[model samples]
Target: MLKSMTGFGSATQEANGLTVTAEVKTLNSKFLDIYCRLPRVYSDKEVELRNLLTQRLERGKVELSLNVTRLTDIRPGVTVNRPLVEAYVNDLRNTSQSLLLDVSDSDLFKLALQQPNAFNSEVSTASETAASDWEHIQLTALEAIRKCDEFRQQEGHGLESKFREYIQIIADRLTLIEVQDVKRIPAVRERVRNLVTELMGSDEFDQNRFEQELIYYIEKFDISEEKVRLKNHLSYFLEVLAAEEANGKKLNFIAQEIGREINTIGSKANDASIQRLVVQMKDELEKIKEQTLNVI
Candidate 1:
């Protein structure tokens, strides 16, 4: 089945008191190009994530981002060092006594608490938290990838339908060209015969040489070979479009072949009617080329 390169997906999950979200977006590209935005803790996993995307999506310009938020408190903000506070308080009390000054018990306690090393603002270790949450983040990313694939499938279906319509229009125009070709041949012959008679006096013209030259001239403008080749190219295009594997490059190459055949027919067809039909085929082929860029 065909798939489009343009799509978007995201997934969010909660684990280990953290909320994690994974988002992915893709666009058409000749090769797989990945851009990653990750939290500092998961920086080491960027290579693994890129490999996963490459294996799944194959070819595209891909952008992935991982976001995290704390959902619950994992540690206290601060903790007091009881022994350090007591030591400071004892030293302060001794100094007050030697100076013959009395200090309130509450004041001494307050002064000790204010001393450096008495308490510490807590900082949770990220290594441990990241190790525990990695699994959840990976699973969320897989889910997002699946959703993006589904989006590609839907867009591809629409493109396929359009392609079928455009191909049919070109086929219809080819038929018109065939019909006009038959009428064009008789008119061309009559005009060429009259010109030959006018250029060379009828009595003086050599009949054998004239016949040979006329045959050669008519063969040069004959579109029968071009018509057959064009028909084959059109059939091949439809066959590839129906294949099980989605090969955008192959399909694009076939389209170029189809255009080549159409151009050959246009240039060889001396009739105005055939030229008009060729113009219509060219228009439809251009549309097909434009839409194929988004295919995968």
Candidate 2:
């Protein structure tokens, strides 16, 4: 089954006064490469997210992002250290008296409390509401991933159909090449006889030597073996396409082999008719190669 490597999906949810949104994007790649942008609270979940993506998408560059927002009333309020504020106030008043720096002042106490570190707090901690909020976030994220996978599958189906059509085109061209090849034997034999007659010129050529030399020349240019291997490669290519596996790279390699064989046949064929047929066959195979780029 062929699957294209481009798709998108997103899911969002709000519950327990927290909002979570997730989106995933995929692009063509030789291997599964997953990247993530996640909230600090959910950073620990990156590995699980990667695994989930790898399991669903056999190969691609994937990006998954999770964003979390806290509602105002549910957030953790600020913290103030009353003991520390009091100590600062006492120390400042004593220092002022010892140094005779400042006159008595009630407003000074308020100024001391306003200093830095007098208060500290994490504004986003969920505390009692953390689990419920996390649950909603997780559910939404999973839904988004599922939708993305569905999109990939549908796109894959379209690519699969195209691959099948290209494979058929290659098979049909192979038939033409085989037919042309069969006609080549008779043509080569006739040409060999004429060449012998011309070269002998008034003296009969030795039949045994002529036969041996002719055999050697024909064997040197024969493309029968290459054609046989190409046909076999095409058959296996179709077989792998039918199987439920990640066979994109394997199919590409097979396609290279097919191209190699076609090249050998093109170069070896010397007849004008066969050369024209080879051109047509090459055109068809090139189309297959172009379409194979989308396989995943």
Candidate 3:
């Protein structure tokens, strides 16, 4: 089944009093590009997480974020700077006196606590919390990635439907071109005959030579070969679309070939009706090209 490069997924897991939330999003890109936002404690796991995502997502611009919340009051060492707090209290009291405002001691203490560097929470050098929560976090991340892949598959189905619809439209236009082509030849033959008679200014011209020239002229404008090749290309495009592999790039190349054939037929047709059909076909092919870029 085909997959699209655009999708989003999120998963949450809790273990050892730590709640981990993982979110992943992807967008269309020519190559795999990964960006991660991880909590400071889990920073060391960035490389491993990137590898895992790369293996699963294949190609796209991928963004991942992990947020960790402690669910329990128990934590590592944390300390209050008593001297800093005293300094903040003194500064606040002096400011209050200068402004002739009376500030309560409780309010001063609260304001001092809100100051930067008022307290320090020490992170363990061994990353004990990160190590303990790694397993649960990994599982949550993997589940999110799995959901993202499912989202991609769903998007892919929609894209496939559109591609098939556009291809069918192009095929129908080709049919119109074929029908018009049949009538075009005889009309062209008559016009050429009239023009030749007018130029010679006589009805008694070399019949055999005129026949040869007319045949050459009609053959030059014949679109039969392009029509056949275009039909085959349309069939091949559907075949590739049905395949299980993700062939977005391959499909794009085939669309380009289809465009080339359509352009050739339009230029050689010399018929306004056939040219109109070619224009319609080109429009459908352009839609296919646009959707193929998002395929994976």
Candidate 4:
């Protein structure tokens, strides 16, 4: 079965006063392009995380984010800058006195806390703790990637159904052309005979020469070879669609062959009904091409 390049998944794990959340989103792309955002403590592991994502997702523009939050007061990493807070509070008091204004202590404290450097959160760098935390993050990330694959699989099923529908439509159109093709040769012969008679008069027109030229002209418009080739290409396209591996590029190449045959038939059709059928086939093929871009 095929996979789609568009999907999203997220997972969160909590342990040892740390809550880690992993999120992954993907969009269609010709190659694997991964972008990551991780907490400062895990910055060194960014390359490992990227490798994990690349291994799971073959092709797409992938955006991954990891968020970590501390939940235990006993292990709090954040500390208030007492000297900075006191300076802010004292400055606010002096300004209030100079302006002859009254400010509550609670208000002054709140304003002081909002200043830059009032508090700082220390990033944990202990090798043992980092290793354990990385394991938790890795498991969470893998879970998110698994969910992403599940989503892609679901979308792939939908794409496969659509491809079958479009292929069927094109096949039906070819059948219609086959039926209409029978009347085409005779109509061309008769039209050529009438034109020759009208231009040179029946007595002047050479029957033997006209017959030879007519055969040549009609052969130029013969779509028998094109029809057979198009049918074969369509069948091959469906065969590849059911393969075990994702062959989006291979399918695209097959679609191009289908289009080449369709274009040849259209150019040589010289009949209104066949031309219309060719147009419809082109429409269906265009839809398939558009959807194939999302396949993996």
Top lDDT hit: 3
lDDT against true structure, model 4: 0.89
On TM-score, the candidate that comes out on top is 1
lDDT tens per residue, model 1, 1-296: 88899999999998888888999999999889999999986799999999889988888899999998888876656789899999999999999999988899899999999999999665565545556778788899988888898999899888888888998998899999989888888988887888788647767788778887788778767889888888888888788788879678887888999899899888878778888888899999999888888888
24-85 per-residue lDDT for model 3 (tens digits): 99999999999999988778889999999999999899999999888987654667888999
Candidate 1 TM-score, true structure as reference: 0.78
Tens digit of per-residue lDDT, candidate 2, span 126-179: 454666676787788788888888888788787777777777777787788788
Runs in model 2 lying further than 4 Å from the true structure: 77-128, 197-212
How well is each residue in 1-296 modelled by candidate 4, as lDDT tens digits? Answer: 88999999999989987798999999999989999999887788999999999899888999999998868754446778899999999999999999999999889999999999999666663546667777888999999998898899999999999999999999999999999998897897787778667746756677787777777777778999999999999999899899888567888999999999999999988898999999999999999999999988
**Which sections of candidate 4 miss by over 4 Å?**
73-125, 192-216
Give per-model CA RMSD: 4.7, 5.5, 9.6, 9.8
Choose 1 or 3, whichever is better by lDDT: 3
lDDT by candidate, in order shown: 0.86, 0.78, 0.90, 0.89
Q: Is candidate 2 or candidate 3 better by TM-score?
A: 3
Off by over 4 Å in 1: 75-129, 195-212
